[model samples]
Target: MHGPLNPESPVAAKVFPSPNHGERKEGRRPDMVILHYTGMASESEALQWLCNPVSQVSAHYFVFEDGRVLQLVPEARRAWHAGRSWWNGEDDTNSASIGIEIANAGHPGGLPPFPDAQIESVIALTKDIATRWRVPAERVLAHSDVAPGRKVDPGEKFPWEVLHEAGVGHWVKPASIQDGRFFSRGDRGMPVEALQAMFAMYGYGIKISGVFDEDTEKVVAAFQRHFRPERIDGVADASTIITLRDLIAKRPAPTAS
Candidate 1:
């Protein structure tokens, strides 16, 4: 927490230390990588806010619009980015994952396309972190994946397929959107329970209740935002269900520790 900052990944050009980090709980080593968008008007403002102690939020690394990467918090430390998040049975996501904030004028700024250079840098940085830390492809997740109703960053515009092609994250071609038996808010039955079970099986933090409630809607939307992004209205259409099933079926096996 002192002295000259040392960049943990070679992808990072320099260190821009932020005071908004703490020790990882129980000395947990990062086994996941969480991607996010700054959702600000400018990259400078986003970077400044992250480094400012008052913001109380930070990521281990920050990527600029033109593809420049900066180390903010040491990889060994816990950055305060994943607030009130849960993933794959872990509530302390900050302690178990490395956070990367991409500088994009996210949803608020019309969900601008990420430059090819910037996305290439993201792929390189993610590959480095996943390789060095032994992070799994499925564990490389969007911010929306962890905090369902609360957060949505590195939004639908993010080229998850590109990252998968670059061997950074898990992905499967989304099933074609179509009409059929779908679940939505207010629906309830054994089918709903089955749907909930499938989502929970895939690491979404949702109760296995037999009713399609608000929380279920939110989780469905979150799943779509990450997987079947073509339509994200919180409705579980055949396309969404098929896509989720395919992802689960094709998920990479856990690597031996």
Candidate 2:
């Protein structure tokens, strides 16, 4: 099939179309932006895999370490990223979001730091997409955020505070870690239920079952990966709870009809 002649965002230098995409479901327009890491040994191989039909995985855009941007799947189409994910009760994440895959060695390769140029390009690309789509800042998220335990791309090493500085995503100064009350797997009660409810209200796919289950731990870790990267032990410590509460407080109010 012929690829698009032009890139969707001006930041994208060219169109290197991927075959692994399809029509967005139910005429849904993208309202979220999901960031990811290629997590492959090389950028070329990663791009090739995304464009390969057999891989069945692709994102709307790809960013290289040197800050080069390429468009793989059109924004109007649903790229095969965000599989089996959920956010704010929306299970069809691929249908409601644009995915940007950044080339990096990732966790397997020792969690290398993202280059300044690369992060700049990401900020520019994200800003353009968010502005054009009118996506809320809170809706910009990490792949790990939607899939927890199952996916952790664009890992904690990724500089979210930098993106926030560029006015891309929502962020707040993480509450300092200190010895205090905490919740972890095996713990159960009203506090656990309230913690789960807070996570759910913040759009994380967590169950308010009053038990600190494995799933709850994963969700907490995922939240830390995005918001409070100083520590991500999956334990809902004082810092984590405070940061989550601050984020909830800072969330934008719904627009009136």
lDDT for model 1 comes to 0.94
Q: Candidate 2: RMSD over Cα atoms? A: 1.2
Ten contiguous residues minimizing lDDT sum, candidate 2 = 1-10
Question: Can you tell me which runs of candidate 2 are displaced by over 4 Å?
Answer: 1-4
lDDT by residue (tens digit), candidate 2, 35-113:
9999998999999999999999999999999999999888999999899999999999999999999999899899999
- Clash count, one per candidate: 0, 0
Q: Measured by TM-score, how close is model 1 to the native structure? A: 0.98
Indicate which candidate wins on lDDT.
2
lDDT tens readout by residue for model 1, 1-257: 46666788999999988899998999999999999999999899999999998999999999998999999998889999989999879999999999999999999999999999999999999999999999999999999999998999889999999999989899999999877788999999999999999999999999999999999999999999999899899998999999999999999988798
Cα miss at 214, model 1 (Å)?
0.5
TM-score of 2: 0.98
Q: What is the lDDT of residue 82 in candidate 1?
A: 87
lDDT of each structure?
A: 0.94, 0.94
lDDT of 1 at 207: 92
TM-score of each: 0.98, 0.98
